[model samples]
Target: MASSSGLLPSEPRTLPSTGFQVVDASETIEEETLPGYHLGKYYPVRLGEIFDKRYRVVGKLGYGTTSTVWLAHDSVESRYVALKLYVANLNNTRELKAYECLDEADEKDHPGKTLIRKLLGSFQVDSHSSNGSSSHLCLVHEPLGPSLKEILDLMPPYSFHLGFLRPVLRNILIAVDFLHARAGIIHSDLQIANFICDVRSSDKAMFAKFENAEFTQPTPRKIISEEHIIYTSRRMSLSKALPLLCDFGETRLFSEAGTPGEDIMPNVYKAPEVIMHMEWDYKVDVWNVAMVVWHSLTGRPLFNGRSADGKIQDDRIHMAEMVALMGPPPLRFLERSTRMTRALWNEDGNWKNVAPIPDITLEKLGADINGYDKEGFFLFFRRMLRWLPEDRPTCEELVYDPWLMRELGLGLGR
Candidate 1:
């Protein structure tokens, strides 16, 4: 039956009896084996299921611990949007508040604002199941393509070209600047996975093809019970690539200063202040941006925090690597959190030898690029990778760094 909007067919699309494969129940499907996954947790979304009487679910995009994202057609607007449906009873008010903070900023002319993925709308959905009735919060956003890491993985060498990397890093810096300066927010998590390619005009065609494929081929899915069905995620095809910083689940808001003593950021990208349990602010993001840029240029992580067995994360090992690369933390820097500092360092600002420092330097590691480019690259890294968070350059300053501008073939004037 045609919906009242007359833009989508609200009835569920019938799948072919023989064409599509039925996944075995015993095998782990998309989110079936997730730690907290159970009946009534994730909304049992089906193809062609309409939400809010407007968005028609077309295909599964991806899933995370807190939510499952789907590609949906907005019948009211006649555009494709990504519906991020959170797990039942998940507290996502922080993420919503971060978006609101960005929205409140008066920076329409800010270049970084465009490089950030925008929240179009949001609503709540009620799901009734054998377990109980639960409400899930759903956020609507413009559908985007694969992440920078995913795109890099698809191509051989799995690293971005210097030419392409320049603009991508610049865009990221701009986005970070907007978050720090204009929006009064801190994106505590900044990594390659959080940087995604924007959907272009050419990429919009992929959505129609995805919908058509769902109608004819139907995604292979595991049917566990009446309340649960797990569908394989479908990747969106993207021809034109533009970087957009996304994922605000770990974002924190700071007005005029810093937020202290809160553990944030992924292990590999943690700032020195974060490790020492001291006050941290926008500079932590600066450190994160440096690590991300370094990782993008080289396939390997700049700092590997894993234990020798690679079974668990060891902060001592991570600090050892940091000292070896960036030199030992200064006495004053260590004094910020005396208790935590004493555990890792001596009175003279020397490492306590819980883990041996790796015999590596930035100069030795970044040996690929030659001469001027190498010098400039390391200079840029020096500006951000400091032992003290306050020593790191602001995102605004990094955006106009000589090395980045020269690589992008832009003058300081621009």
Candidate 2:
């Protein structure tokens, strides 16, 4: 949230992406401080540190491979904000551009569309630490609550009302549409963790509904870890519980001529195009979001690709599962995946390198998909889980699909 106090708003905020932060070739590390935080070179920012000359860090929100987010008070604007600081080496100018495009848009610009988190501002700061002189890019954003993954962890593994999922799915679809069609960006990473609950939703009943809910706490890492604080929907209520898309580091603007790296999305939510190393577009986001909706509704993954031994099956296994459940991959896609020809398939378009994994069919995954319009639910799935990316519906189409419509009480399709 941009502060109304006018500190940053008072200044000329636009700046170029270059300058500062030299890397020494001889530098090496023997030990690291923060675990689960190995994505980039971390800056040793102590608590209560003033950032970008204005915002004061209050608490750490969360940390990821590339950056660490904090709950900050923008003293200049006199408003709370989400402050994301990225390590110097990551160089996330692409993500910065994505937010710049979104900054020009608002919910009012698109009538009846769902809301997405807004980026307030961004600036770079140079810090000299024991690790060396590093330049960090700090982005200011509207504050959001815990993630869907955190929310789910707060509940019993299977405890959630099916009806509670409709708004979330709708909201996510709206954000995806905004990213794909409006912003010309693809959310290369789409997972439960990337969806933050709107902490300031005005819906009282929505917040009240989860008052009695339990939030799972993280295990002991450092004694000062945020895990020590138990967060219920009520206690950590930054505002409301409306779900919104967050995290743009992994996002990329899609184009026909440009071919992004094949390994773009998370393993669990990867699209078939990504699996087969095809030049993909917005369709990958559709595949990812379908799985997200499924998990949100059922509290179980659409594809539980890992076994009891914690061995997540390889891509060949994943491809076999997808093929068994959704039928064969498109012939062109199979032919294009020649890199894995010996390990995944044969000349006959049949599985050769992988054995069939049991209980992976759509019927099997949807067995517990009751207490709602089951047929309509599968209809949405079929439209989304297509073998060919070109054949899948766009975000605009899926948002109005009969299944979403039924859940939204807008009537069913044939």
In model 1, the worst 10-residue window by lDDT is 1-10
Give the whole-model CA lDDT for all candidates, comma-separated. Answer: 0.82, 0.65
TM-score of 2: 0.79
Worst 10 residues of 2 by lDDT: 224-233
Which residue pairs does candidate 1 place in steric collision?
none
Query: What tens digits encode model 1's per-residue C-alpha lDDT throughout 1-414?
Result: 232212344444655545667898788877777877676788888776899998888899888878999998887777778999999888888789989998888787788889999999999999887878889999998888888877877876777766678778889999999998898998989999899888666456667677777767778888877656788988777547787999898888886335556778888888888877888777889999988988887766789988999988888999999999988778889889889888988888878899999899997887663334666678888898898777888998988888888855685432
* Residue pairs with backbone atoms closer than 3 Å in model 2 (clashes): 1-141, 1-142, 5-77, 154-214, 154-215, 199-239, 199-240, 200-239, 200-240, 201-240
Q: Which candidate is the best by TM-score?
A: 1
As for model 2, its CA RMSD to the true structure in angstroms is 8.9
Error of 2 at 411 (Å): 0.7
